[model samples]
Target chain A: GIQVEQSPPDLILQEGANSTLRCNFSDSVNNLQWFHQNPWGQLINLFYIPSGTKQNGRLSATTVATERYSLLYISSSQTTDSGVYFCAVVNGNKLVFGAGTILRVKS
Target chain B: GEEVAQTPKHLVRGEGQKAKLYCAPIKGHSYVFWYQQVLKNEFKFLISFQNENVFDETGMPKERFSAKCLPNSPCSLEIQATKLEDSAVYFCASSPQTGGTGNTIYFGEGSWLTVV
Candidate 1:
């Protein structure tokens, strides 16, 4: 099984602040995705980046496959952004997830 | 449908009972995937289907877990003799799997199961 490690197990920030989350995998992957688990338990897809950089509004992500690492950046955070963020990689036939980074944004 | 749909958002069962969950993948999508979130932050892949056929099911517990994706119907995951640890949020995801975009997967709101 492929191993995934997320940094800064937990995070707290004020609304409108900025933060970055990281994910590192032990093996190269064919697909790498970032997700935000909402309060209601919906796993929202943030990014599906195997390599290179992508941005969607205030959220952005970059994957360095060669280094087996990825980074997610959230700018102008909102109270709605408080949730758990996960990075999962496709290991052969399945998607292996990291433990996740818990984020709390206070207004 | 634009997104995956799961039925019975929450379910409660007793130990050794049978529990089942259902998911309807997006229309026209050919790939369906199932995942289990035990704790708030941990997710485990359960199975994946390429259309109506099983693609990979390495994460399923052979003795207690079974899944099926029959044509013209929603996919199902069944756990017989459910244990306390079987309590978790089961999520269903799907992708169009067309062109170069098939690898991107989308998830549903999830079905929460609890064993008391």
Candidate 2:
């Protein structure tokens, strides 16, 4: 089993601000994904980056597999971005998840 | 359209009652996973299936929990004699196959279960 830790457990930001959330894993992973759980409790997949960098609109993520760390960046954030961001990794057969970073983007 | 579809967006059951949840993975997906999220905490893996075979179920509670995935039928997770602690959001996810590298798992909206 792999251990995952997320930094800055809580964050508050005004609209248009930028922030970076990080996830650190204890072991090598083959699958890495970033998810956003909305206020209504819907889990939406944001990124599935096991390595390299990827961007989708205002959200981007980079995973350094060798370093066993991943970073999620939100640019020009909107109020709709307020929610809990989760980082999940798969070491072997099971997917391990971090506690998540709660972000509040005030309009 | 959502890749994974879970039935009964919300469920309420009395303690000691049996609870059953269903999940239908995306077409062509071979792997299906079930996770439980309590409050705002991280997801707890329960079980997974690859096609019609059970792949991994180490996270399942041996006593009151069981799951099945039959061919041409939707996958199911059943909890017998449910307890108060069983109240949580049950999420169903699916992927093309298993392995760490490059596999992307998609999740359903989740079924909220309240045991009283």
Candidate 3:
């Protein structure tokens, strides 16, 4: 039962602003993922970076496995990105998720 | 393309009634998972299947919850005698690897179950 904690439970920013969200896990993990739960409640896969850096459009993520931490960076945020950002890790057969960081981007 | 599909975006049932939800994993995926997201709580794993076989169901409430993955059909999770606490968003996810880093798990728009 590894614990995953997300920082800054809530975040608010204006459109076009950049922000960083962090996730810290308490144990080793075989896989790490960042998901965006949009307003429609769709969990969109953003990245599957277990121990490296990955970038996709305005979103990027980096996982430092040794340190048991991961960071997600969003640049030029849009209203569409206003929702919950979750980070999940695999602890054996099951994947555990954090409570998630609630992001609100105002236009 | 890499997305899981769930049916009946919303479900409402009376207390003590049975609630069933269906999930269709992405094509070629071998692993399917079911999770419950209660209010103010993180997603909790309920069960997982590896091609019709129950891989791990330790998280499932053995009392009144049951799940099945029929051959060539969408997997289903049924909750018998549903209660108010069972009212939450149920999410289904699928991945190519059972538990590997290549594990790009994709989830569907969860099915919200409201039991009154």
Off by over 4 Å in 3: none
State the DockQ of every prediction: 0.57, 0.73, 0.66
TM-scores for chain A over all candidates? 0.98, 0.98, 0.98
For candidate 2, write residues B1-116 as lDDT tens digits. Answer: 34799988999999999999999998888889999999967699999888988888889997999999899888999999999999999999888866334688989989999999
Give the alpha carbon lDDT tens digit for every residue of A27-74 in model 2.
Answer: 998889999999999999999998999999999999999999999999
Off by over 4 Å in 1: B98-102
CAPRI classification of candidate 3: medium
lDDT of each residue in A1-107, candidate 1, tens digit only: 89999988999999999999999999988889999988777888999999999999999999999999999999999999999999998877667899999999999
Top-TM-score candidate index: 2
| Fraction of native A-B contacts kept, per candidate | 0.61, 0.76, 0.71
Q: How many clashing pairs per prediction, in order?
A: 1, 3, 0
Off by over 4 Å in 2: none
lDDT of 3 by residue, A34-104 (tens): 99988877788899999999999999999999999999999999999999999999988778999999999
CA lDDT scores, all candidates in order: 0.91, 0.91, 0.91
Reference-based TM-score, model 3: 0.96
Per-residue error for B74 in candidate 2, Å, reads: 0.8
In the range B22-115, model 3's lDDT, one tens digit per residue, is 9999888889999999873589999999999999999999999999998989999999999999999999988885743457788888899999
Clashing pairs in 1: B97-B102
